[model samples]
Target: MTIKVFDTHVRTKTSRYLHFDVLIEGNDTEKAQAHARQYLLEKGLTDEDIAQSECRFCHVEPGNPVVAQAISQQGYYILELQGCQED
Candidate 1:
């Protein structure tokens, strides 16, 4: 599985979280989601630390390159199974 990571800014009324969006490439949504959760856990993210996020395949066109570059610079494999897929 191949994946990319993007820094995401999530803000609430009280606080903000500097989270990461794990972008996975594959035809299967189930596989992608699984890979993402596992990767997060290995990086020390608890289950509560992750939120289900979706990125439309269409919008991924322009943003793909930029995301790829960022992931490369970060030096994280961004691909590994940490847990089973959730329903």
Candidate 2:
């Protein structure tokens, strides 16, 4: 199966916008955003509403075995591209 890839940008009150490619099993923007929020929480990033902190669908591609595991568990996977690992 294919996945919907959303180009995501998240910024904190005191930090710059961090980039992440959020991959989900479906194309629902709300669902994708929700999942992205959950990811931030898991990473201890933020708990405030992320309504303005999400998604622009960039592409659809074939299945990726690497991300399949995460998608199966949380309905999505995050590809960290820049400034996502620092404190």
lDDT of each: 0.41, 0.79
- Clash pairs, candidate 2, are none
Across residues 14-76, which tens digit of lDDT does each residue of candidate 1 receive?
Answer: 232333444544334454456545654565565565444432222232335655665456533
Per-residue alpha-carbon lDDT of model 2 for 6-85, expressed as tens digits? Answer: 89888776656678988988889888788777777877776553434757888999867888887887678899987778
**Model 1, C-alpha of 17: deviation from truth (Å):** 4.6
Cα lDDT of model 2 overall?
Answer: 0.79
Look at candidate 2 and tell me the lDDT of residue 6.
89
The candidate 2 region of ten consecutive residues with least summed lDDT is 46-55
Off by over 4 Å in 2: 47-52
Model 1 ranges off by over 4 Å: 1-25, 51-87
